[model samples]
Target: MMKKTLTALLTVISLGLGGIGFAAQGFAMGSDSTEPAKKADDYTKAVDLIDDEEYAKAIPLLEKSIKEKGEYADALNQLGYANRKLGNWAAGMEYYLKALKLEPNHLGANEYLGELYLEQKDLASAEAQLAKLKAACGDCDEYDELEDSIDDYKDDNNIN
Candidate 1:
């Protein structure tokens, strides 16, 4: 009888410690955050819509996320992408600049901003964004994509 009690106590202690560890990990990962998740949900939905090429639909969701969570660089970057896809150059530029202002090292924003520059045929400006990307995340996909774009632009325009 004593041995059974000891075994049960040990099991309870082990389970309790494991539960505590799991809770701590969740909290550290923000899964157990006290903050509301609506803003994150909005951003996630916007990203899904963007993935589907529904830029028009994603705009409002991203805007709502930005309104709820001010200075959210990711949402702002996606907003810029949506607007750029819709051919709203000025709006796209505004959002991208705002995001970059908040987080200058944002890889996606820098890449999209560079693409916008390329759209305007401003090779110098595009190259400047590429340089920033290279400095921020050396040899990253953003840098590679922008470099490819610059190369394509140069080839297309017969520019050395």
Candidate 2:
């Protein structure tokens, strides 16, 4: 009887350890998989479209990239840019916000979202985004771009 109990206990312990091992492996696979490579290909294609100012063509590709990779910050930022270029301000803001949530230091999102605010005549919010970009990368292109935009906004509005 004691031997049977010992055997049963060993079986249970082995099963428990096996379950833990499986869970750990699944977690690693989920996080460190090569799925991003496929999504990155889609993202690169979308970026090419965006560069051509073909926002309508880019949007669907960006959407696919984000859907496949989940919380893909660059894809989300590009989606925001495409939507904003298409004059879909609300949708653009939503995408930008999602990108920021995923990576608060996302340079593209900060710059593009600042541009969106400027379009909406929200100088204060635009300046806030500029500050965030400055905090993230003091001398980066994103900061310079947004700063120039804000300067243009001020000059255009004669805000002094």
Candidate 3:
């Protein structure tokens, strides 16, 4: 009984910190809906801009957010995405890896990093990140097409 209880507690804690915690983690807006403090609003607003597909508009916002919170992995990750959409692949990918550095197990960051690596013909790095995600993913909820995409990339690149 005690073992079961402990297992349940551990499971709950793990799920709570999964992708569901993304916004609240304050990397971007975190995984929650609550507003950030005034000082952190730049990051929060940047996230909103990203969602609206205003990548160009998001640029300075994200830059300012990071200036205010250099270690905010979420902002870094979103900035990467924004840059990617703006055809700034190199810079976008740089920020993606930066986010991963700040939060090693960040699933979205990991998946995006793998995708970017694949784009650059960096199969080794992509494979490494995919392996990490395969090992640590909880629901694997967001990885459905991601794995298939990696496989496709390898086949296209003849990376085998």
Candidate 4:
């Protein structure tokens, strides 16, 4: 009887540990409502590269991630960002447009695209993107950053 109780207690402990393991995995893969779960290894590496300001190195990884994950909006946004940082304006715009096509409410894409417009001195286009960002996420960092960029651009250009 003692041996049976010991076995049962071990089984219970094992089951609890299994549950915890699965939950941890879910959290690591970003199981949240705001963003989709991203499980691509290349995507993660590319994000790290981008964080380090290695835009050129991040491009191929981002491309591989898109190929592996089937064109996720976040990956496309990162592609746009990398290209923009490298001064590939047309390519950056194309990637941003693709990302927006996939996920219209993508905050990063909107904010970055707005900045791109500002770079080209297209204040109206930039403002349009800002409006989209505001509609997508009211009172968010992306909105505030884009708004500040717009203000700075206007100030520098003497727009008003």
Residue 112 lDDT in candidate 1: 94
Cα lDDT, all candidates: 0.88, 0.87, 0.75, 0.89
- Cα lDDT tens digits for candidate 3, 1-160: 9999999999999988786677556576435222355236777677788888888988898788667755566777887888887878899888988887777777777777787777777878887877888877844843654687788987887777
Q: Where is model 2 more than 4 Å wrong at Cα?
A: 1-38
> Candidates 2 and 3: which is better by TM-score?
2
lDDT (Cα, tens digit) per residue for candidate 4, span 25-112 = 8779652122544537787888899999999999999898778668878889999999999999999999999989988999999999
How many clashes does the backbone of model 2 have? 0
Predictions ranked by TM-score, top down? 4, 1, 2, 3
Per-prediction CA RMSD (Å) = 4.3, 9.9, 11.1, 2.9
Q: Please tell me which model should have the higher TM-score, number 1 or number 3.
A: 1
Off by over 4 Å in 1: 1-39
Candidate 1 vs 3: which has more lDDT: 1
lDDT of 1 by residue, 1-160 (tens): 9999999999999999999999997667542112444356888888899999999999998888877777577888899999999999999999999888878998999999999999999999999999999999999988999999999999999999
TM-scores for every predicted model: 0.79, 0.76, 0.65, 0.82
**C-alpha-based local distance difference test score of model 3:** 0.75
TM-score-superior candidate, 2 or 4 = 4
User: Model 4: how far is 154 from its true place, Å?
Assistant: 1.3
Winner by lDDT: 4
Query: What would the TM-score be for candidate 4 when compared with the true structure?
Result: 0.82
Shift of residue 48 alpha carbon in model 2, Å: 0.2
Candidate number with the higher TM-score (3 or 4): 4
